[model samples]
Target: MIAIDDILEKIVSKEIEKKEALRFFEELPEKEKSYLVSKLKTHLSNNANSVENNFSEKKERTLKAVTELQLNEEHKGFIDQMAQKLEKNAPKSKENASECQTYFVDQRRTGGLKKALKRLQFHLTYSECDGAYLYDIDGNKYIDIASDNGVNLFGHQPDFIKEAISKRLDKGYPLVGYTEELSQATKLFSELTGHERVLFTQSGTEAVMWAVRIARAATQKKKIVIFEGAYHGLSDTVLAAKDQFGNSIAMGLGMIQEFADELIVLDYGNMEDLSIIEDRADEIAGVLVEPVQSRNPNNQPVEFLKEVRKLTLEKNILLIMDEMITGFRVSCSGVQGLWKIKGDLATYGKIPAGGMPSGMIAGLTKYMNYVDGGTFDYDDESMPSVKKALMAGTHTRNPIKLAATLAILTEIKKRSSTSENKTDESNSCFLQELNEKTRLMCEELNSFFKTKNVPLIIEYFSSLFRFKFLDDPNGVVKELVFVLMRINGVETSPSGNCFLTLAHSDKDIKSIIRVVKKSIDTLMKQNFFYISDSIEEDEIKEDIRSTISTIPDMRNDPEQESIKNDQMEKLRKLIISDLNNFQEKEVTI
Candidate 1:
């Protein structure tokens, strides 16, 4: 086997560029390369786990080595190549049924499994993903718009994250209990969320369950107030919804009937509806909200949230913000920092785990103390009986998850601390650019639909967007549109929820607009969307002109910018005034 340390030392001593060293390393036989990587990882881990007295010394040396070995463009390109090679050998899908059948029972709703196969004329059995793309079993490639429900922040197979996790694995995975990684993750969570205390869980649902229990225990109240269409979790208590008359009702078939009595479901975004909380303030434990409602993202009224804060404060009710989907997606501090409304407690998951499965319950010390241990003064007769909140699981403090979380938090803080004058190459600036590109994509989609006199529109909440159809006269046109999107090499959920990640470039966004336009045209040819009047040769050309207008000059070239602007004006005329020219021509799809 090759001496990994010798190679590393040579790279650090500037005898060879990091890129060239990596190239040499990649050219080795697979078994040898894997052996060399494992050895290096083990060497790093042993040094990392040294005695406390020598820890700083070891860390300084390790950091120096890592700085020299840091990945550059060539290294990332090599990693992507390796990822693709691995995907090339992925096992074939089962013959009789889709792979989703083995994992979930309801295949129809789970990312268009059976429907995509039968309707879209193809199936996508993914082998691996890297950054913005998914590679399937048959070697087909597709750009992922869904982002596995928005879990990937920097995208799949990020080199820095992979290295960090590999280093932790070399130290040995602590599946049974806590480790220094767990402590580090806790400290990072506290610093990032501004929460005084924290608890870990295996999934978002567990975090929500813990938050509700903590809220109830801390306030000594039995009933909780929740908003309609707010998905806190699958827990019995949080599964209730507000009916037409604003009464709490269990949403699921087998949900506990009595759970409704423990909840007060109110219409979200309706300030007047919150008045009911005033009457029940004495009995209410807390109010659970999504900050930006998942169902209605376009209407995140700041006034409503401020009123929520004021009402909760005046009535002495706790506020629990569920940032499961909105946590890192919205901002580094989640919605609390974005909207500047701090809550008594917040539940986070999704991107908080760095594409892994982990959840967090964070809150004030007074509230979190109910879950953590402490012996009260039993001798004090005035003390009320404290109902301890149960919030532990076998996977609560798994070291692997903690390491991934630490990596994510470290990157987040590092990116956020960059100077304001830095260019877009910085991660924070790139995130801002990503969000802007997403907003522009949404705007372009809506404009294309309206210009062609289609009934569809796209709406967004931060980087998350969903498609909306004004009228699906064919009863299945919406599903057909989704199927068309899949055939066009983009994956999205059936509910039309799409997400944008930091991995997505301006080129990716442009491709999305072009793919969507192609999908719309395909659906029209298949007689999908009901176009009242169309079918002129000039109309088709006009549609192309409209799409071309949406493509911006992201290359920073002045000539290209001017050309794009002129095209935008032509598109405006074609869609706005010239659209009248097609009103008289009758065309049916």
Candidate 2:
């Protein structure tokens, strides 16, 4: 017999399973069982509060570090230099920069590093995009590794997609109503995803939001289970994270705290988390998964996904595969096809419309019936039967979008037919060739990093790859690397993520590797990897402001010239002192 105190301690420490603890409680006398239940509730409540407090403390520390890094002199100077170079190379982009700065609120372009970039008045205004390249207004070309955030599976403005859009425009480009294009596109998507029903939305976020609603209506359950670090769009219901105690916490402000009440956040790729779903099976409406998280592509939990599929089926809960990033990029059928694990419902965007904005929700008919009222025959006077859920959008099935989608699906079908049995090693088909090229590029880059002993590594899942730091304690080195890459004429996602398109060539791949090598070497020479811990934040900020004011373009203000001169003199003294310190260190060595 286990002592009550022992069981309570193990439960608090998570050493014993909840089920085991319950079994032990069941064996106790009635009075003891009641006492244990009360104690257990209290312990769990205190544990939750402790977890929340820890998260708050860690968040505070991170914000402080970010503030300090932002004020670092070297970081500011590098960004200013990068901005000046970009402005010189792309004069027209500079001329038109205000149009975007004044009207557009693009967080992706200016979020975390906004203050530095904004002060420098930096922006990238594209004039045209062709195969494997983006041309700025001033005619400077950059290899398009960003690929419009993975929407351009075949690169920018592919001829096939362009032709499809042109054909639709010539046909008057109906803004509303169904067409044969919609029917064919739906049929193709249904066949590709192996889902019986298909519904279109204007964006991936809408698709996910509706999928959750449909699941709730169909299952009559309120709770949704999503994994940590998995992005399922910006919907209020799905934008949440698991605190240390497994309680739901909204990821951002403006989200109602109660919106996360029915959400159960779980640890991605953890087998033990499956038991939690089982424990709360009766209340769960669905399990939403992103097979490869766009932010953290290294996590490809195949076996765990298989187990989720099995568990959801056994428990009669819906499984929603959010393939907004992985869909049509990894394979013709997305992760479900690649991993051979099926979800009851799947959401797709990005590549599905071939660069056109569209979203699709495909699922088994039983659950999808909630979206529409199931099939009804007009001649038989049969009315819609099943319960309905609200799902409507102005651009849900735009004719032009459907035409482009049909064209893309047709192309994918042709490529997939030939590549069905081919592995990543085979270059027999276009998709396989692209995948192989990406794999080889990543392998070569990883090998170079290893040989150079650079504290950076690349992780990829198919054509999607991201740069990760091995030791960036302050988390500022990655941002520096991104700026360096841009200065070297390579564009990447703000998070240092890259998506290789089918349009990228062997030469382009080599150029990318060269740019990465150059960027890393520059960072190493500047000693960016070894940030000094002793520098005071106020001193750093003052030094950077002084340096920035000394730049030739910033000399327009005559009144501040005297102050600038004094700051420059101080900066000169500091530089000489640094050199003297370096000399002393060398003599000591």
Candidate 3:
């Protein structure tokens, strides 16, 4: 028996490629090969920039294409058939990707990008994806809503996208240095979005990096004004502006404090703060803002955007819009059109690449095109800091990915335009049902809270929604929300916010709602919350009405000091009691 370490050492040490290693492992027969390789030791770098570029793992739908509905008699029958198949041809773990999975698992355990899902659990696996479903290690299916976080917009292995890639493959090399496909794709993307020209980069962070460069080039300014609660990607220069809670990632080693020192941070949608920026417009190159704050709060009001536009125009500073998440999912017209604001440059990614690593910087000619030749081309290929600007890495213009990109944009428009962009038919027939289900679940909980007078923020936007357990993150309900969603086959990202994909059917939404209701009932029973088992709609309505009734009547109440104090005291006591109760039922999530 050739030892497993001997085999993997040969491979990792460059003694053999993956194909050669596979052949060598094939001769081992049984779990012997897998078990051996799993024990081999290795190390991965945690330095921020040393991490493999993952901008292309765009969000994707969270399920499988197996057409398995709520485990009824029909699915039960399919399970029996599957059981028979398994009995006849049980998969030998040694013959699978056990080695690769093990490597990532061990590496992620030490804090790498591909964090291990579980030591025993298969959170990391690779499989051929087709259509709306995602297949994992053991062929388990999940309905992806974070659309792989916005690529694969038209779905994985979509026929149109696949055919396009196939057609491209039939031709010669799809990418040959810097050429026309880049420009043509740019034109198509820009034409649709109402931008004059598009500058193609390979990831969202790259788009952000270039946006700063363009602003610098046009204004001859050294500083950029970024929002406090924004994420333009993990580029070195952008690290100063932390994410929602302010954990400074992208600060591993290469990112010096001086680099972040150049970026001026401002609050999101603070119109008056523009005066601070306005007083320093000569020094400030541009104001970068996300149209909708995705993930953290995942909510940006339209009025907030209008104020941003007004302030930027008044200050005569460049306004760079980061629309990475809102481009495709928010509306067919993208963020600017959805919110009625204009931007000099719109940083795009997520869905535009069809689940591929890609990014685009779209802007007008006067400012965007300035950096091409007439300005600083300070060696992106030569200098380390600048190298990122020039490097698209391998497969930047992969024919397969391009084909998928073209298909996704076309399909999204077709579905949206024909039905007038998420019409009653689509919503009532599909998304609305899911949205209502979620809304109802939250409504039920909030009603109970209102009766208890517990303050909560049950945020919702269209079919995408998640209740932030801010009142008490230590509570059991926060953890149950994740566990129940997974058990019910409605898996969402751990990041609190969720986006509903077209792959999720109305029936599936109902199932999710059923699971949520049951989960809520469970949590209540566990005293995770103090909601009653027999919560009635009338009681809920009355609670809502009473809450509304306390709105202070600003028109009549010139002296509302007593009301404010009373409300504050009520809130304070409720919070104290809730936290005490939470301590008894909390799970250390």
Question: lDDT scores for all predictions?
Answer: 0.64, 0.71, 0.52
Write the candidate numbers in order of decreasing lDDT: 2, 1, 3
| Model with the higher TM-score, candidate 1 or 2 | 2
**On residues 1-589, what C-alpha lDDT tens digit does candidate 3 reach at each position?**
2245345434433333445554555565333332322222111111111112211121121111111111246434433443344333324322353565545455322221111112212133436565555665555565555456545545566676677667767775546565344555666676567788776677889889988887777777877877755788878777663321111223333456577667776667666666667677778888888777764444475786677677677766789988887675555446677566879898888777776677878878777656454234466653222212233446656655566566666665455454543432331232234446556655665555334332233555544565544323322234444544444444555445566555556565556556655655543444434322222322332343344345443211337647544654453344234323433443100
Candidate 2: clashing pairs of residues: none
lDDT of 2 by residue, 136-205 (tens): 8788789889998888887888888899989888887666777789889999988776789999999989
The TM-score of candidate 1 is: 0.69
Q: Any runs in candidate 1 off by more than 4 Å, and if so which?
A: 1-96, 99-123, 374-387, 421-430, 473-475, 531-589
lDDT of 1: 0.64
TM-score of candidate 3 against the unseen true structure? 0.62
Candidate 2: 10-residue stretch with minimal lDDT: 59-68
lDDT tens readout by residue for model 1, 92-192: 53331355667767533433222212423234567789999998766667788888777787878688788888998999886785688787888888986
- Candidate 2 lands at a TM-score of 0.76
- lDDT, candidate 1, residue 33? 40
Q: What is the lDDT of residue 393 in candidate 1?
A: 85
- How far out, in Å, is residue 421 in model 1? 7.0
lDDT of 2 at 440: 88
